[model samples]
Target: MTPLLRNIVANYTSQLYVILIGLAVVPQYIKYMGIEAYGVIGFFAMLQSWMSLLDLGLSPTLGREASKLKAGVTRAGVLKLFLRFLETLFSFTALVVVALSWILGPWIASSWLKLESLSPSDVALCVVLVACIISLRLLSGIYRGGLLGMERQVVANVIAVIAATLKSLAVLPLLIWVTHSILAFFLFQLVGAIVEIVLMRIAFVKALPSVATEKFQWNLLREPLRFGVGLAFLSGVWIVISQSDKLILSHILSMQNFGEFMLATSVAWGAYSLISPLQQAVLPRLVVFFEQNQHDKFVLLYRQTTMLMAAILAGVAGTMAAYPEHVLFAWTGNLTVAARAADILRWYVSGSGFMALAGMAYVLQHARGDVRMHIRGNLLNVFILIPSTIALTLKFGAIGAAITWAVTNLFFLIFWTRIVHKKFLPEIANSWLTRDISPALLVGALLCVAAHQLNWPVSSRLLSFAGLAVLVVATTGFLLFIQAETRRIMSFFLRGIVKILCTKNV
Candidate 1:
């Protein structure tokens, strides 16, 4: 297989593995750790998202520079120097993160989280450990970006799988056999983060060409920093827009209720995971195509990948949104938990579906190195989303926040994508929506709705899960079959198989 295709497959494999493992283990985590403790784990996840704001866009900028290096638009030595500067900058920032976490941990445990069973002191310690783990993982992003930009995705994925296995699966044994202390969970994750960063650093250095006398230059920051600053602003706004509901709800709800909300959110996030692998695999190639002025190739890749993403994301999201109670019940085997989280999950997954589609436009802008429009769009979104989220969440609780989430992303997908296409890719804009995206979306949604109406007899959790799996497969197949490109490819393969059979008969 070609490198790009191989990279995409490898990325999908790694992501699927990680996601499946997490899915399999989460119910166990809630069972063993208790719902309140799981809330702390969810809090840890939110903290990591918040901490990414500290990156200030350097990681993605570095990834772009690495892509330039591979295209020979940048020299190896220059890329090495830039990498060192970012390393130093991130290191100092990590220190600040730790210090702030130390100060804020106690306050969050005491004031922010409405804890019932867990000790404040123990939760506070877990918060500190969360900071340490997040910091180390943040440092790993630098190397991870470099690897991806260089298109060494196989190596990057290998490291990711290893780290995920250790951090996720290994923790189960520790929790089961060693101790159920939440602090122990975070401690194990801290060790995994350390191992991950060390592996990433070594792999990144090895991937670089042998260059003598590489030295960091402070002046080199000027060009990339301009791009980084725009991205940083965009990233900050995005985090606030996306995480505001969670942050608000964290204080508003008790820890148990928050955990239930988080459960729904986590499942909803699987929609993004469906699209993320393709986005990552295509981004470096998109950058290379743009740099080389391959506009035709760039547009083709963008549309094709967008359609594929639509097929996968729509099927999963539509199924979950259409049958939220069925999905939650099948996965968690707790009808009460399923009932509690289902309404929230429905809207969240629907929102995530639109958000994932809108992300394609964002990737288009990112490849072209112009995020000014994206920044403005996000700024507007934040302004509207924050107040609305607060009002809705307070008035309606988790469901209110979820409705706002779905509506905001739907608005962004409808309007922002047009604005982006008008500027960067006007030629394909109409076709992109009418042909590339709309077909799969329509088919997937209709299939899901039909399946839900059928009301298949899913008497047990096992049968319910089987029913959902069949629905997903049928939806995906129909969506792909309706797409012209995928249909053409399928016809070619079928013709080849028929020819082989005729030759054997002759």
Candidate 2:
């Protein structure tokens, strides 16, 4: 397989594995900790996103810096640059984590998070534990971006698979055998975070050996810092866009209801997972292409990747929209939770699909180092999204939060995309819609409508899961392979697979 496609597949494999592990663990976690405790865990999930605001765009900037090496920087030069970058990032992230944990942790545990079963002390301890986990993660995140810049995704994903397994699957035993507390759960994650950092260090050394021997210098960071400021704000804006609804819903709904919402959010994110790997795989290459002033190649890669990504995302989103209740019940084994979240999941997942498309546009802008469009778009969301979320939640409750999320994304899909295309690549403005989006939407909507109308009996959970799985495959395959361009790419991909198998056989 081509290196880009290979990286995408490997990354997707790792992500899918993590999703499955989390799916398996959720029921056990809810059973052990109960929904309120699990909701606290969900709140921690939101806190992780909040904590990422401290990243200051350092990690992605690191990736962008490393990708510049493709322009022919020496190993020593690259290592010097990287070490300087990491030093600044690690030091700043560490201090922020300490400050945030010390100041905000107590407030969040005591006042912010709405708790029911867990005591204030217990909740406080969990907050502190999550702080530590996020701190370690913040420290280690640069290597992940570094690996992406190096195009070392296969090795990166191997390390990620190991880390994902330890953080997720290992938690079940920790909860069952060790302690049935959220504090204990997060403590285990802290340990996993440390180990992940260590493995990332090893992977970095292996992937870029000279980096291990180089001395650090602060000078290399000056350029990246200037670039990173915009990126950092962009990251924060997105985190706000993503987490604002959940934050509002947390206040409006009870802890148990919020937990149900969180569950559905998790599933929506899993669908979005289909887009992320492809985005990461394309980004370094896009940067290199832009740097080389190859606009045609850049546009081609952008369009092709968007088509493939949108098609895949459409299928995943369609399935969730079509079978939210069945899928949730099958995954969580709580019909009440499933029932509560089913409607929200449909709206949220549909929005996620649109968000995935917008993500591609955002990535293109980032690759070009043109953050103006994205910044403006996010600013618009801040003004519109936050107020709308608050009003909707106050008036209509949790479902309103979901609707607001969907509407905000749909708005971005039309508005931000037009601005991005107009500013960057006006030529494909009409073609992108005609070729990539409209057809996929038509197919996805039809699949959702048809699948929902089917009289599939939910007599057995396994049967329901199997039926939904078929629908997912059918939807994804129909959209993904329907277009002539995508079909051609698939044939090439298949040929690559065949070539690999033949070589192995020899």
Candidate 3:
């Protein structure tokens, strides 16, 4: 297989493994740790998202630069110098992250979070550990971006699979056999973070082309600094748009309720997770295409990947949104939790699907080395979303916040995406909406409605899950079959299989 296709497959495999393992283990975490403790874990996750703001857009910049290096637009020595500069910058930032975490942990545990069963002291310690783990992982992103930029995705994904397995699965034994304490969970994560960084650093250094006398150059920062600053602003706004609801709800809802909300959000986030592998694998190639002035090829790749992503996301999101109670119960095996989270899950999954589709615009912009449109769009999103989220969460609790989430993303998908296409690639904008995105979404939505109407007899959790899985698969297959390119590929594969069968009979 070609490197790009291979990278895409590897990334999808690695990401799917992480998602499946995480899905499998989360209910067990709630069962063993209790919902209140799980709330703390959720808090840690939010903090991680917030901490990404500290990256200052350097990680993505590194990835882009690495891609440039591979395309012969950038020299290996300069790439090495750039990596050194980021590494050094991150070292100081890591110290600051640890210090801030220590300073804020006490306040958050005492005042910010409404804790019930867990001790404030233990929670504070876990918060500190969370900081350490995030800082290490933040450092690791420098290397991870470099590897991805170089298109060494197989190596990167293998490391990711190993790290994800340890982080998600290994923690189970530790929590069950060693201790159920939240502190123990964070400690295990801290160790995994350390190991991940070490592996990433070694791999990145090996991937770097051999260059003698690599020296840090201060002037080299000027070019990426402009791009990185725009991205940093974009990142900050994105965090606010995405996390403000969760942040507001954490304070407004009870700890147990917040945990349930988080449970729903996690499942909803699978929509984005499903699309992210394609994004990562596509970005470098997009950059290369743009650099080579292959505009037709670039648009073709963008439309094709966007279609595939939309199809899969529609299938997953429609099924989950349509039958959230069954989805939650099948996954968690808790009727009470399922009932509590079902409405929230439905709305959040819909929002996540739209957000993932809207994200394609950002990828297109990023590949072209301009994101001012994205920045402006997100700035507007932040101003509107933050106040609305607070008002909704306070007025209607989790369900209200969930509704706002869905509406905001849909608005961006419709309006902002159109604006982006008008400016960048106006030729295909209407066709993109009509042909690329609409078909899969309409079909998937109809299938969801039909399935719900059928009222399949899912008498048990296993049956509910199996039935949902089949529906999703069928919807995905139908969507794919409707697409001309995918249909042709599927036909070729089927004909090959038929020929093999006939030969065997003869």
How far residue 417's Cα lies from its native spot in candidate 2, in Å, is: 0.8
**lDDT (Cα, 0-100) at 347 in candidate 2:** 86
Q: In model 1, which runs have C-alpha deviations exceeding 4 angstroms? A: 488-506
Better of 2 and 3 by lDDT: 3
lDDT of 2 by residue, 339-367 (tens): 88899898889889888888777888988
lDDT of 1 by residue, 67-124 (tens): 9988888788888888888888888888887888889889999998999999899988
Decoy 2 TM-score against native: 0.95
Model 3: colliding residue pairs: none
C-alpha lDDT of residue 2 in model 2: 78
Q: What local lDDT score does residue 157 receive in model 3, on the 0 to 100 scale?
A: 91
Candidate 3, residues 1-506: lDDT per residue as tens digits?
Answer: 45777788799999999898889998889988999988888878987998899899989999999998877897888887888778888899889888988998899999989998899999888878988888898899999999998899889999998888888888999888878898989898888888899999999999988885357666776798788999999989988888888888788777888899999999999767989888999999999999989999999889888888887887889888888988989988998888889999999999999899989999999999999999999988988788888898889988999999999998988888989999999998778777888887787578657766876543589989988899789878888788986676457657766787999999
For candidate 3, the per-residue lDDT at 374 reads 94
Candidate 2 whole-model C-alpha lDDT, 0 to 1: 0.81
| lDDT, residue 146, candidate 2 | 84
Residue pairs clashing in model 1 are none
